[model samples]
Target: MEDRKKDHIDLAFSSRLNGDMVDNRFDYEPMLGIHGKKDLSFEFADKIMQLPIWVSSMTGGTKRAGTINKNLAQACGEFGLGMGLGSCRILLDSPEYFDDFNVRPIMGDDVPLFANIGICQLEQMLQNRSEGELDELVDKLQADGLAIHINPMQEAFQPEGDVLKTPPIELLKKYLEKTDLKIIVKEVGQGFGKESLRQLLALPLEAIEFGALGGTNFSLVELNRSEAVAAEVYNPFIHIGHTADNMTHTINQLVDKMGYKIKVNNVIISGGISSLLDGYYLTEISKMPAIFGMGSAFLRHSMGSYDKLQSYVEKLANGLQLANNFLRVKL
Candidate 1:
């Protein structure tokens, strides 16, 4: 106790925080709650996740992906978190990389595991009347559902990107008519605008993940892969989009105004959620059932040993529990 006090005294001067550094989003109520684990479990996509954390999709179809996915799935199983796999597009044409994305055995059947695919690929499948391939892919992986990521900006920037013959909204409206699979629509980085959100909310989607701006901008990724001149021309496009907080508030207002019209009842608050507090704040303020997801954060830890990934997820769970116990949103 004496040593702790001495260390606190020594660190006090350097630890002083000012106005801008203060997180004004929450009221830190020390008197109302205890510093102990609170039940954070919630039903999402018809499955229960012990922690409100989703390991956002990162990579697959590579030699290293098998290791990374195994590590991530093991962590999810141990921690009771949901996960979305990186694009399963490659698996549609060939089964050569199946093992890389085959983590259901490691992840178990309890928590939710989603298979991801791009909007363009789905559009092609629907056109070709090969949507059954999607079913086969999901069935083989034993994923709970499908997450369709829409990124026109990213596609436009890629040198060999697929050209969209029909608008994404139209394609989605058409595709929903055929599939019984629970669908989750998400942005790759550039989030949905108000109209886009409204349209999506009107659909019978399982969830809409805010793969908002302030995270990995796939448009920027494509630009970086392009020629220098082309990159410069399209650089400004990457900066356009909404952040997670902005989308959360927008959705809340939309829900207030168009209550019954909103069909999608759940959301995964992701993109630019840098820490547990960010996740807690957004999920608290959201009008719908929401959980937060992290991609780069989980990817970083998953690249190492399984122990490393487990430790990282443990910290996330611990921090989130502490936040839920004492912190309340200021709104």
Candidate 2:
């Protein structure tokens, strides 16, 4: 037993956190009694999430897409968390792949479920005056709203890419006029800069999801699948744009500067967030109604059985509750 203890101590020494991680994030207080998970509650997307985390969109119309979507929806319904479906582009043309995206029935009516579509598709709909198709997409999904994901970087590297014809924000202005569905504008990866955020915040967006640089930048995803020469040339673009923390801080300051001019009051702080502590820190510092989102992290467990996702969410909720009780975000 002593030998086992010595081996464990050696392993712990190798994995110990460095001094660089030290900061005034949480004030240690031993006197307060430990709290239970029941104490934590998060209200977002017009419903309360049992946990303060979100199952951000991923895997649509791909292999085992139906299974992935169903599993994610079940977890969302069970945990009281919100979800967004990946690009509904496949469902736009036919009902053949509709089962892959039709997860609203599983996520239920209480927790918010938003249908997603790329900016390229939205541009096409606008140019053609084909907004009816989008309206139908939402109706069929029984989703609360639509999230227009802007992905210039991803599209740039994607083969046979639909090169954007018009400026996205301008197209968004036109798109909003065409449909009354609730909207949240998000980046695909390589998050918005100050000017972009400023432009978006000035509009009547329901929320902003920072598909920031530190996360799985879809630019890199597309590049990896591109020709070797093209991938090498475009690789540097992946590092561009803001982090979740940067975006959150800029949002707070910009809102303060813009005040009433800012039409947005909700945001999904996502990208590169690997833990409940990260979510709590960003959510706590946010100036508006906020919910932290994760793509790969949620996707990792979501691809498996329902129990896997459920257990992951249970830990996140409990962790969030503990953080909320003992830690405070330093403004």
Candidate 3:
């Protein structure tokens, strides 16, 4: 554990000071494009919804995580938003953990729920699992879609992180071709750029979650747990990547330039989305149908007391309403 902590710190420092220009380009316009004028209503695998805002993927391994996910699902159901569960790796690997992670009780048939798994874990599924086995996992949770998260930086920072051996684009294409369900291409903390997005767009994907850097700094998380060398390498770039606002704008612009050639079902603007205004601004500026908020701030107010959670949900709802009204008049 001590050595792991050191490795994190090294990776953090290296990433921060490395002086790499993080790319931020989108093929769509910021306003008045395919996503802006087109009807937001769309079918996500088995679920259909009018709103685009979704409760972004968080955690679901421990009891506390399960509680959080349950509350989040309830909130999502109430708000008419989509919801995604955290990585199912631990649960899939350990039956004991799976028994404890109860997401079904919180999910609703009407709500769009997505099951998440990492690229590294895809190898496990390919080894012995059949389509029916994978489908059973989603069926058990009543998920509407499957999200495959890419987080090489997160892994490199973590001491026990999986070494990403190859590019996942081919694997993702295979999964897309095989699954009869919606496949969401997501990033963990490091946001996606033009090249990566183009590659993903080539696949038959349902959506993209640009998990921009700003909210949760997993690199920093690893740094706190890392040691000498890794810490030094990754510490400087704590705020290394693009902000949520920048990423959203870029993606919107990129999608517009592409002339709506790629049928991206949704664009999830996550990371650093805190207050109602942040949500409002993101929804206004981006062409994507929805925005995702994942940090503890939103969850902190939503968990435990129903009234408190309701109030928090209302605030976000009001913000979206305001944005929609303003867009109606402006556009």
Best by TM-score: 1
TM-score quality measure for candidate 1: 0.97
Q: Write the per-residue lDDT of candidate 3 for residues 14-128, one digit (tens) a residue.
A: 7674436532221223364232222445455556654556677777667777667767767767766677778877756576766434565665577678888888777546544
RMSD in Å for all candidates: 1.3, 2.6, 12.3
Candidate 1 Cα RMSD (Å):
1.3
Error of 2 at 108 (Å): 1.6
lDDT of 1 at 220: 90
lDDT by residue for model 1 (1-331), tens: 9999999999999999887887888888999988788889989888999998888887798888889999999988888999999999988877899999999999898999999999999999999999888888889999988999998888999999998888999999998999998999999888889999999999999999999999888889999999999998989988899999999999999999998988996999989988889999999989999999998888888887898888888888889888988888899
Tens-place lDDT per residue, model 2, 26-50, is 6655566368544455665566767
Backbone clashes in model 2, listed as residue pairs = none
Better of 1 and 3 by lDDT: 1
Task: Output the worst ten-in-a-row residue range by lDDT, candidate 1.
Answer: 57-66
| Deviating ranges (above 4 Å) for candidate 3 | 1-51, 127-132, 326-331
Q: What local lDDT does model 3 show for residue 234?
A: 85
Give the CA lDDT, 0 to 100, for residue 3 in model 3: 100
Cα lDDT of all candidates, in order?
Answer: 0.90, 0.84, 0.69
Model 1 stretches with alpha carbons more than 4 Å out:
1-6
TM-score of each: 0.97, 0.92, 0.78
- Regions of candidate 2 where Cα sits further than 4 Å from its true position: 1-23
Query: Model 1, 230: alpha-carbon shift in Å?
Result: 0.7
